[model samples]
Every structure is written in C-alpha cells, then in structure tokens.
Target: MRKMALVNQKGGCGKTTTAVNLASCLAGKGRKVLLIDLDPQGHAGLGLGVKPDQIEESIYEVLSGKIQIIEAIKTLEKNLDAVFSNVVLSAFEQVMAGVPEREFTLAQGLKEIEDNYDYLIIDCPPSVGLLTFNALIACDEVIIPVDSSSFSLNGLGKLLETIQIIQDKAGHELTFRILATNMDRRTNFSNRVVETLRARFPRNCFETEINTCTRLREAASAGKPIAEYDQHCAAFLDYQQLMKEILREEAKMKAKGFALKSFVEAKEKVKEPMEKEVAFIIEAPEDAGVQIAGDFNNWVPESLDLTHSHGRPVWQKAIRLSPGLYQYKYLVDGRWVSDPSNKKRADNLLGSTNSVINV
Candidate 1:
C-alpha cells in the first residue's frame, strides 16, 4: 500500500479538499482507500459529512495510544474508510511533546494495520509541528498542495527542506510531487505562478492543475466529494484528471521496478532517435520576445524565440537536441533569467545559475 500525505506548512492550500476528493475518486476506481485526518482542525471528517461531535474515537486516540487504528476508523463510502481527528487533538502535540520516539507515533500506529487498505491518503495540518513531523515519517510519498497565489509559492522550498530533514535524521527517504491548486487560468498572475512552479520543479510538478472552481467549495460545504456532489462539475473533471495522472505515474514507477529488465529492453528496442525535444519556458510580458541562450546554440541570445502557448502569459518553445546534459537560460525582454521550474542548475562564471537539462 502507498501511504500518501497531502502536506503544506502554508494554510488555505486545498489540502483537505484534495485529500477528500482525491480519496473518493481513487475509491471510485475500486481501490480500497483510507483517508487519515492528521490535522487537529478535523476538517477532513467535517468536509466528508462526518460530524465532529459524532466521532467518539479519532486519530488522536490512535496517536495517543488510547486505542488502536481500527477502533477509531469509520467507513464513510463504499470503498473508503476514514480515521478522523478533532480539536481535542490540538493538545496531543503538548501531550506527546515529552514522549520518546514522538516522530514515529503515526507511523507505528499505521504499521499494525498496513494491509487493510490499498492506499492511505493523509490530510496534514497547516503547521510544521509535531503532527506534521509524524505524517512525514509515516508517509511513503508526499503531495504538497501549493496554491497559485504568489505568496504561497514561497513555501515550496521550505517544505522540500523538511523532507530533506526527514531523509537526514529519520533515515526515511520519500518521493514528492507538487500539485498546483486554486489555479485561476483567467488571470495572468495565477497562470504565471503555475508556470513558475512547473518550471522550478518540472520533474515533481503534476501536469494536471486543479483549476479554481466554486463547485469544489460547494461540495466541501455540502459534505461530499466533488465526484458525489456533482460529477459533471468542473471541479470533478479537474480532480478526475488529477486522479488519472496519479494512477498513470504510479503504474509507470511500478513497471520500472517490477519489470526493469523488460522495460529497459523495450525502451532500447524502440530504436527511436536519441535526439529529444526539450521545452524551454519562462514567464515574460506578452509582447516580450524571449530567446533561449545556451551551449546548444553557442550561447546566442536570439537563436530561438519563445511564444505564448494558447493565450497563456508564459512564453514557451520546444527545441530538438541530442541526448546530453545542457546548461541554458532565457533572455526575457533582454534580461537573462533561469528557468523557474528547473531546480537543477549550475552557477555560471557570471554569478548566475543556468538551468540544467538532461535528455
């Protein structure tokens, strides 16, 4: 089972919404899903129509050693069960603050019931406190929901640092992906934020952006996943695409692991040209003529001009190049800048980081 946590230190990033709807959608695909509410706020349960006052035992009990996980879980949907939490959990951090092995509390509790579900989706609290630490230790993977607002983008680096801390101190390695939520494509500011996030973490960012939709809020307020509330709603469609992307990525990773030899053989036998098409993107004024400069074109600034993609604010260009590592940057309206989506970069002699791409 893949235990995935939707975590973000910043608030109002759609962590609960993604957890509720994503869990429901996965369950709709016939996979047994357990949505664990690790937050003290308990919105996960409340959003699912699970009354806060009605739930007797929650994840708080499980975390506190007062009860086992199964005792606290309640089946909400056909293929989905929830381990809810509430405000009482706010005291848990202080209670467990003095306990030994505190960071592994959540991990230890879930380990006993590991086989009960095909996937576990955890809704983490907004703060990077003890609860969030436990989630990090317990989860096999993390999906950081970053809002499209410019300010929220600043938290991405900090969360990545937290994951690095887990890797260093806890000795647990985890893969992570970024989901851009609350994206308003109609506004250039939001679109630019999304593009910048994609450019900074190209390998980790999901291609499917959860565009802003009022139906998402309506579903939450009505105590239902978008799928159950209004299947035809725009929110439902966006989440459906997100679910499909998640499944596809997981399948590809699984195939790579279980069928490594065949996969490699098949890839080698494809006999496709070694040259790859690399997409260079950067956010610039609509009328600004962005050009790419790198070793690929002998550092010529005006060799390749970028154009907007389907009325989007960001400029993009796809160039075919042979298999190799290349250092490149964009000249946006005459000013040079590194690709914001690519974190892998090298410091040039000019004291600027050049984005690195390998094909």
Candidate 2:
C-alpha cells in the first residue's frame, strides 16, 4: 500500500479537509483507501459524517494496544474505510511517554492491514508530538497543506525541521510535497502567497491549488465530502485534480519499480554531513529584489540574491557555513533591514542592529 499523511503544524490550513476529500476522491476512483484520523480533534471523521463518540473504537484504541487496527476500522463507503479519533486521544503523548518504541506504535499496528487497502491517508494533529511522529514514521509521503495567509508560512521551517529530525533519528526518509490551500484568487495578497510557495518549492509543490470556497465549509458542516456534497463545485474539481496528480505520480513510481522500504533501508546507511546547510528565509514583496549580505562574504550586499521559484513575497537562500558566529542583514530594494524572523541581533556602529547566526 502507498501511505501518505497530510501534516501541518499550523491550524486552519485545510489539513483535515484535504485528508477527508482526498481520501474520498481516491475511493471514488475505485481505489481502496484507509483514512486514519490521527488528530485528537477528530475533524476528519466529523467531516465524513462519522461521529467519533458514536464509534465503538478509534485510532486511540489501536495505537494504545487496546484493540487491533482492523477492529477500530469503520467502513464509510464502498471503497473507503476510516479509523476515527476523539478528544480522548489528546492524552496519548503522556500515556506513551515512557513506552519503548512509542513512535513505531502506529506503524506496527498498520502492518497487519497493509494489504487491505491500496492507499492509507492519515490526518495528523496541528502540533509536533507523538501522534504526528507516528504518522510521519508510518507514511512514506507527506503532503504539507499551506494556507494563503503569510502567518501560515512562519511554521513551515519548524515543520520541515521536525521532518528532518524524524529522518535523521528514525532512519526514515520521507518525500514531501507542499499543497497550496485556502487560496483566494480575487485578492492580490492571496495570489502572491500561492505564487511564492510555488517559486520557493518549485519541485516540491503541487500544481493544483485549493481555492477558498464557502461550499467546502458547507459540506463539512453538513458532514460530507465535497465530492458527495457538490460534485460540480470548484473545490471538488481541485481535489479531483489532486487525486489525479497523486495517481500519476504513483504510476511513475511503479514504472520505475520504486520500493519505499528498500529505499529507506538504503538511505539509513548514508553518512552524516560534516557541514550544515543553513537557510535564510524572509518575506517580502515580489518586486523587493532581496539579497543576503553577511560577514562570511565580506558584507557584500549584492553577492547573494535570495532566489525563489516564482516572485511572490517569500524569498530564501541556503548556504553552507562552517561552525562560527556570523552577522547578516537583508538588502531589500537597496535598503538594509535586519532579519525580522531572527530575534538574535547585535548593535552596529551605526546604532542599528544586524541579525546574528551561530552555525
């Protein structure tokens, strides 16, 4: 089975909505899909009209070893089955704190039902915790749903850091793709955010963007996926395109005889890097023309231009710097500005501050 998880540390990023609708769309395509509600909020189940309280068992029971994974499965449609969750799942972290291999609990549970479905979609919580770790460890692919709001972009780095930690510590290399969600095409700011995301992650972003639509909210409120609620709606079409894109990628992987398990095993044998690649990211308008100037480059303002995929607001540049203390600032539109994202700053001779970084 091909396993994928919808994960984002920020709330209201359409993580759960994507999980529900994506799973449904896959099932609608005649694929057997298992939707796992890993979030304690249980929004995934609610969106599909399955009340967590009404279910006899949930993912909590499966992960906690109170019951087998199959026992907690609730059939939602002909080809879609879901493992629900509830507020009680919030205690999972504390409950499994001292347990050995706690992070592998969910992975082990899914072993028995590996062949029962063609796809496994997990909806992770809005926090980086045990449950999120389990989902990440179990899934080979991760879909990071990012909203159009600039605030949503702030947590992307932290989430990427968490993913890197799982890969380095658990020996699991996961492929992730960013899906732009909650986009409002009518507004210039929303369009810019999407454009920036695509540029920043040229190879890691999906072409399909989920536009903001009230019908999507109505569907969730009415306890249904967009596919079932309004087949002709724009949201439904967007998700349909997403499903097709995923299937096409799957086809390409199969054509190449891709084996996720073997790939991960091979990756585990790779050596660690001696130097760290530090990324400098800043938000600015598309026309800002941002660049990084630092002591490493003799404070040359025009030495390194922050490059992005498309020109939106967000701009970033990654450079390998050896262990040392350095100070830098961004040259935006010929004006110098300290990194707003970095709190560590040093006062210069001019009385202004420069961002400090120790690598």
Candidate 3:
C-alpha cells in the first residue's frame, strides 16, 4: 500500500481539509483507502459525518493495545474505511511517555492491516508530538498543505527542519510535496506567495493549486466531502486534478524507479548555500502586517512581504544579495518606517531616512 501523512505544525492551513477530501477522492476512484485520524481534535472523522458519540473504539484504543486495529475501523463509504479519533487521544503522549520505542506504536499497529488497502492516509495532529512522530515513522511520504498566508510561509522552514530531524533520528527515508491550499487567485499577494513557494522548493511543490472556494467550507460544515456535496463545484475539480497529478506522478516514479529519492537528495546537497544567504529582519507587533520595501525591486512593498519568525514577534525575509550596500524600510500596516534594528541610515529622496545595510 502507498502510505502518506498530511502534516503541518501550524493550524488553519487546510491540513485536515486536504486529508479528508483527498482520502474521499482516492476512495471514490475505486481504490480501497483507509484514513487514520491521528489528530486529537477528531476533525477528520467529524468531517466525514462520524460523531464523537458514535465512536466507541478510536485510534486511542488501538494504539493503547486495548483493542485491535480492525475493531476501531468504521466504514465511511463504499471503498473508504476510517479509523476515528477522539479527545482522549490527547493523553497518548503522556500515557506513552517512558515507554521504549513508543514512537513506533502506530507503525507496529498498522502491520495487522497493511495489506487490506491500496492507500493509507494519516491525518496528523497540528503539533509535533509523539502522535505526530508515530505517523511520520509509519508513512513513506508527507504532504504539507500550505495556505496563501505569510504566517503559513513562515512555518514552512521550521517544519522542514523538524522533518529532517525525524529522518536523521529514525534512520528513515521519506519524501515530501508542498500543496498550496486556500489560494485566492483574485489577489496578487496570494499569487506572489505561491510563486515564492515554488521558487523556494521547486522540486518538492505540486503543480496543482487548491483555489479558495466557499463551497469547500460549506461541505465540511455539512459533514460531506466536496465530491458528495457538489461534484460540479470548482473545489471538487481542483481536488480531482490533484488526485490525477498524484496518480500520474506515481506512475512516472514506478517507471523511472522512483527518481524522487534522488530529487530529495539534491535538495539536501544545496541546503548550506541556501541558509547562508542574506536575511532582512525587523521587530513588529505580531498582529501587524509587515513587508519589506527597498530599491531592490523599485520600492514596491507588495512585491516582498516579511514572514513571522517562529515563536517570536519579529518578522524576516531571506534573499540573495551580492556584496554591496542597500537601503530599505519596513511597511507596517500601511505606514512606512525605518528599521529600528539597523543603526546605519541613509537619506532617501522622500526627505526621510532609510535603514542601510552592507552585504
């Protein structure tokens, strides 16, 4: 079976939405698919119309060894079966703490029914905890659903770093694909974010983009996938294209002997130079919208936005620069201001001072 997990430490990035819809679409294609909800919120099961009260035996029971995997399985559709989750699953980390090889609990449990499905889709929790680790250990591939927001872009680097750590510590080889979700095609900022993502991770990004659609949210609220809610909607078409892209990639990989392995290795080889590039950072309120504007690109702030640093109020932008002096300013919530962190200043034509830096 082809196993994959949808993971992102940041919330509201369409991680659960993608997981539920993708699994439903895959199963609709006549493939036997199993979606395992590793999230404590139980949103995946709930998205499929499985109420919390209806779930007596959840993934918590199976992982705790209180019941077999089959006992927790609930048939959702013709070819789709799901292993539900509940709030009690939140206690898994504390409960399994101090146990040897606890990271492999889910992996060990999957061995019982690994042969019964064509695809195994795991919806991981929003945090990088023991439950997320178990999903990582069990899956060979990861799909990171990123939204067209600056905050979402900010978390991408840290999430990649976490994945690298998991690979090194577990001694496992895994590949990842970036899926752009919640995309608003009408806005230039959204388009720019997608362009930035593609430029940063060209080899790992999927060509299919999930556009912003109200029907998608309505479907989730109605406890149905886009396919069942409205097959003719744009969201359904986007997901169908995404499904086709995945299947096509799988076929191409099988024909070329899984060339993506080398693609991932190539990314690792260029990691050092990428990290050494110049970065522009500024301190701003977490609630304020921040962007960098300078002579680099005709002083258009919309062309370059700053991303929030992980767990901090500071925002940053990393860009390649040659050895030269540059002047810039920060555009915070529509007001242009000099960078407080940079002491060096230069007079601009606008009768104001701009922060100066030498690379």
Candidate 4:
C-alpha cells in the first residue's frame, strides 16, 4: 500500500481539502483508498459527508488501542473508507504520552491493514505536533499543500526542518514534495511566487498548481469531494493531474531502488566522506541579495552572500558547510524569505525555517 500524508504547519492551506479530494479522485480511478483523518478538527471526515455524531469508531480509538483499525474505518464514497477524528483527538498527547514507542503506534496500526488498500491518505493538523509526527512516521511520503502567498513560502522552510528532525529521530527514509494550491493566476504576485517556487524547488514542487475556483469552495460547503461535485471544474482537473503526477513520481522513485529504510541503520552502512555544497537561487528581484541565514550561521546576515560574479542578474549563489542538520533562508534586501526554489522547510518560533542536506 502507498501511504501519504498531507501536511503543512499553517492552517487554511488546503491540507484537508487535498487529502479528501485526492483520495476520492484516486478511488474514482478504480483504486481502493483509505482516508485517515489524523487532524483533530475532523474536517476530512466532514468533507466526505461523515457527520461527527455519526462516528462511532474513530482514529482516537485506534490510536489509544481501544479498538482495531478494521473496526474504526467507515466506508464513505465508492472505493473509499475513512477513519474519522474528533476534538477528543486534541487530548492525544496527554493520552498517549506514556505509551511505549508512541510515535510508532500509528505506524504499527497502519501496518496491520497495509495490504487492504491501494492508498492511505493521512490528513495532518495545522501544527507540527505529535499527531503530525505520527503521520510522518506512518507514511512513506508526504505531500505539502502551499498557498501561493508570501507567508506560505516563508513558513515552508520550518516545515521541512521538522521533517528532517523526524527522519533523524525515527530513522526512516521518507520522501516529500510540495504542491502549490489556491493559486490565483490572474494576480501578478501569485504568478511571481509560482515562478519563484519553480526556480528554486524544481524537483520537489509539483508541476500542477490547484487553481483558485469558487466551485472548490462550493464542493467543500456541500460536503462532497471535488471530483464527485463537478469533474469538469478546474479544481477537479487540477487534482486529477496531481494524482497522475504523484503516481509517476512514485514509479520513478521505485525504479531508483529507494525502499523505506531506517536512516539510523542505513547511516551505519555508509562510510563515504560527505560532500557539502550550498547553492542559492534568488527569486524575489534583481536587487535581492540572497544570503543564507539559519542555525548554522546563528541567523546572521551576510554570512553566506551570493557573489554577483556574472554582473548580470544570475539569481543563484552556492556555498559549502560542515556535515550536520541546518536551517536557512534567503535574505532578500533585509526580508527573510524561504528558498521558493525549494519545497522542504521546518517549523521555528521566528516564523522562518531552512532546508536540511545530509552532506
């Protein structure tokens, strides 16, 4: 089974919407999908037309070991079964704090029914907390939904860092990618942000962006997936394309012989000297001095400024650093912005984050 988590630390970025629509769309394509609402808000279940009061067996019960996953899932929509959530899930931290291997509980639970579905879509809450950690631990890959806004890019760096931290602590090799959503192409700023994202995160960002459409809002209000509401809507088509892109990417990763392995065990097998390189591609403007600032440089400005060697606006700068986890961002004319060029970021208190390169 293919497990994926729709995650983003910021709220209102379409994380639940993407999870519901993607699962429903994939199921419509004849794939068996299990939608797991890990968020305490229960929005994913509600979107699938499952009423809160109607949920008898939920993710909360499954996590607390009160019931088996088979008993918790409710079939919603054709070829789709969902494990809903409730506000009671907010107490999960306190409830499961003393549980042995708390992070691995969800992973173990999913493993029990791993072969029963083609896809398991996990909808993570807005904050990168214990529930998000459980989703990350349980999933093979993660899809981040980012709005085409400045703060969206700004918050991305920190999200990626948290992923790295999880990978380090859990020792699992999990892949991640960013999908830009709610993109308003008519606006110049939105277009510019897309361009900025494309230039920096070419490999990690999806080619398709979920376009802004009232029909999407309508679908949500109606408690129906986009594909079920209107397959012809731009939003529906976008998700279809996204599902295709995701399948293709997964195929490529499998062909590359990348299996889900514990990074801790895997690291012990690697003895080669790590090569470190820092490359920055500026996206804000020509006058932007894209400097690397993060924990590595004590968040100081001018620590790693891109050289304007070519004279013309060559938008990128490269640097080198020691082997360790690092958080950084491009300082564009005194404004702290994430590498729109990169999709991976981590959460931090300053509302800024950086990417991690093992080397």
Q: Give the best candidate by lDDT.
A: 2
| lDDT, candidate 3, at 295 | 43
RMSD of each: 11.0, 10.6, 10.2, 8.8
Q: Higher-lDDT candidate among 2 and 4? A: 2
What stretches of model 2 exceed 4 Å from their correct place?
Answer: 258-359
lDDT of 4 by residue, 21-140 (tens): 999888987889999999988998788777788888889999999999999988876789999998989999998877778988899888779778878899999998899999999986
- Model 1, runs deviating above 4 Å: 254-359
TM-score of 1: 0.74
Q: Against the correct fold, how does model 4 do in TM-score?
A: 0.74
Question: Which residue pairs in candidate 1 collide?
Answer: 199-340, 199-341, 199-342, 200-340, 200-341, 200-342
lDDT of 1 at 329: 83
Candidate 1 global lDDT: 0.80
Which regions in candidate 3 have their CA more than 4 angstroms from the true location?
Answer: 256-359
Which digits, one per residue and each the tens of the lDDT, describe model 3 over residues 1-359? 77889999888788888988989888988878999999989999778888888899999999999999999998988989999999999999999989999998998999989789878999999888899889988887899998885434336756776777777766877778899998888888788778656644555789999988999889988899999999998899999988888777656655655444343344344344532367778777778888886544324464244455676677778877544466678888889889888899865434677787776
- Residue ranges of candidate 4 with Cα displaced over 4 Å: 250-359
Clashing residue pairs found in predicted model 2: 199-309, 199-310
lDDT of 2: 0.83
The lowest-lDDT stretch of 10 consecutive residues in candidate 2 is 263-272
Extract clashing residue pairs from model 3. Answer: none
TM-score for predicted model 2 compared with the true structure: 0.74
lDDT (Cα atoms) of all candidates against the true structure: 0.80, 0.83, 0.80, 0.77
Tens-place lDDT per residue, model 2, 1-359, is 88889998888889999999999999999999999999999999899888877967989889899999989998889999999999999999999989989999999999999988889999999998999999999988889999885444447757876887786666766877899888888988787777555534445689999988889999999999999899988999999999999878666555557653343333334323555889888888766778887754435554344455565557887887656677789988889899998999865434577788877
